[model samples]
Target: MIRVQARTEQSRLMTFASPLLAIVLTLIFGSILFTALGKDPLQALHVLLIMPLSDAYNVSEMLVKMGPLLLCAVGLSLCYRANLWNIGAEGQLLAGALGGSAVALAFGDSESMWVLPVTLLGGIASGMAWSAIPTYLKLKFNSNLILTTIMLNYIALYLLIWAVHGPLRDPMGFGFPESALFSDAALLPVLSDSGRVHLGVVFAVLAALVAWFILSKSHLGFKIRVYGADEPAATYAGFNANGISWFVMLFAGALAGLAGVAEVAGPIGQLTPNVSPGYGYSAIIVAYLGRLHPAGAIVSAVFLAILYMGGDLAQIEMGIPIAVVGMFQGVLLFFLLACDFFIRYRLVSSRETVA
Candidate 1:
């Protein structure tokens, strides 16, 4: 017989090294998997990893992909820190894109600077409203967050599809399921003349910085930590658990909304049925890989963004499906969770324990 035993004390070194170990293990597993598929593992891994950073142009593209990831991850890290388990960042992001596009379209051909900010705020507000529903259900009716949020993701996707097909459809493009091109003032500014990198990257990094300060430097952060650590104790100590939940959820929604709007307003240049290639969903792995730390999300986001670049390269160069890239993410997350489990507990024989 076997039993799982909790460690007497946490492994500080493991806490820092677990993600590293997981990455190494994932690489090894990936190599074996590629070989089994009759592909040269070294070549496969090269295209998936090294080739994405082999050129300046590719690097710029990677940064573009990283923007939404970093933005979404920062918000998720905070919500996870509060133990809120809000899984609707994807929905909030979609809502933001939808909301921001509505505002941008409403402005028509006008080139006013205010168009950008107002459109962005509309996106943020939409995200907040999207999050409010699940938060309300959880607090008021004790609904399961995972289910509600997951359901909302599908709802959000269908709604976007409906909008682009019916209301926001481009009237001039012969009925394409897309909105009209946003004006110059409604778009994010490019960071440089050389590539598509834009102001969204700056927003993502600034969000991480702000989140770090909130989690590490504020009185509210302390209360959040306490509430997450022990709800009964937090209640006894007069911390408002409900307020913390609302704040974290809303904050997460705002950032995710910004990510959604920024995608259309920055790179894609218009709203569509697919504003994201699953950045909000991917950010969940990124949050845990970062160990729920704001700064850590930056590193994880960059790595995942590289994976996105490499996935495209791999499909073009090696005939690998893009689905494989998502599989890698799922595997990496599984390994990270397994490594984290070992860091906190160990298995022992029941006979040994009895003795």
Candidate 2:
């Protein structure tokens, strides 16, 4: 029989090794999934991992997809570190798009270059405002944030659907459910000629660096770490858990919102019903896969971005469903969590008993 041996102190070696193990496991299963689909596993793996890196154009596209992922992951790291489960990033992202589009459509043509900044701010504020509801409920009524945040995402999605279909829909768009295209000044400038890589990458990178600094170096970061490690100890040390909760949710929501705006203003350049293909949700995986570290999140974000690109590639090359991509992501998360078992406990084998 296999038994788990709990360690006195969590093994730091296993802590880091787990992600590596997870990747290996994911690859093993992914190959199986591809083969089960009647596709060449090696070719699928090559397209999923290698093809993206081979072309400069694809590289730029990967960076474009990575931008919002990094942004959302950075914010999520804060909330995770503080032990605050704010899972409404998807809804928060939509709220940001709605708010930013409202601003951009209203004043995109104005002579003031301030429209872009104001739009960005509006998006961030919208995301924060949406997040605050659950935060307040959790703090005051002791509500389950997990349930509230998830329900809020659906609400946000319906709200966006309503706006695009009813109020915010472009009048001259031939009845399409989308806002008008943004002005040149309202759009984020492209970083290169080959693809849609834009200034959002810079923002995402900066957000990661800032998150790293705060979580690793600052006093508030220390408080958050303490609170995550031990709430009683944090309270004993004079840290207000409620305050930290609010800050973490707001900050995370803001970053997620900013990512939404970046997606619209940089690549899409307009509000649509489908502003994201679950970027916010995938970011949850990014946070854990990165082990809740900003630097690690960056790496994971890029890796996930490749998965996104690979999904498209697979669809084109192998007639694979897009769900295959999501399956890959799910497999990564599942294996990563399974690998986490080795961090604090080791497996041992003993005699098997017949039932």
Candidate 3:
């Protein structure tokens, strides 16, 4: 007979190794997926992982893609650590893009560099405002934040669509559902001439550093962790859970908003329905894969961005389905989550358990 047992000491090594293990498992799953699709698995793997970094242009493009992921992941890390289930980063992102685009379109003619900062501020404010709704509902009416935040996503999306169809629509765009082209002053400065990479990459890296500092070094971060780990204990110790929720949600929303600002100000150059190709949703995967740690999330963000870049490459080279890219990411996240289960629990052999 076999008996299950809990170890006196948790597997500390597994905690650190889970992400790497998940990555390896993802690669294996990807190979199987490609092979099942009748594609050359080795070639697909090479193109997906190795070839993208082989050229300078692709490297820059990778950075461009990584920027938003990094920014959003940083904010989400804070919220997850604080036990605030703010699942509306997608809505917050749209709100930010809409707000930032308003600033850019209104001041597109001005040669002032202040437009960028103004746009960023507008985006952040909009994001925080959007987040405040669920925060307020959760705190006051005792509503479930999870459902409210998720539903708000559709509301924000429709608002964006309405803007493009009406007010933000370019008069000379000939019925195109997009705003006018942003002026040079409204755009982020390019890091390289050939690639679409911009200064937003630097902003993303800085955001990660800020997140690390806040979560690791700040007293507020300690409070957040305490509250998250044990709510009853936190309440007994005098920490206000509502206040913590508000702070974490606002911070996360602000960061996601900054990512929205960066997307329009850097790459897309105007507000459109395609402002985000699921970057907001994808950042959740980045957040968890990074173990809800700022530095880890940054690394995970870069890796996920590579998947985006690699997907494009694979599409061109092998004619693989675009769906495959999402599948790969899903596999990675699924494996990561599964690996985490082993960190606190492990399978025991029958002889060892019986003994």
> Between the candidate structures 1 and 2, which one is better when assessed by TM-score?
2
lDDT of 3 by residue, 51-85 (tens): 77888899899889899888888888888887887
Please report the candidate that would top lDDT against the real structure: 1
Which residue segments of model 2 deviate by more than 4 Å? Answer: 1-3, 348-355
Please give the RMSD to the true structure for each candidate, in Å.
2.3, 2.9, 1.5
**In candidate 1, what are the lDDT values of residues 1-355, reduced to their tens digit?**
8999898988787887899999899999989998998889999999989988888778888999999899889999998888889889899999999999999999998988899999999899988889889999999999998899889988999999999999999999688899999999999999876668999899999999999999999999888888888889999999988999999999999999999999889898998887999998999988999988999999999999988899999899988889988899999999998898878887899998888
For residues 278-323, what per-residue lDDT tens digits would candidate 2 score against the true structure? 9889999999999999999999999999999988877887788889
Cα lDDT, all candidates:
0.91, 0.89, 0.88
TM-score for model 2?
Answer: 0.96
Clashing pairs in 3: none
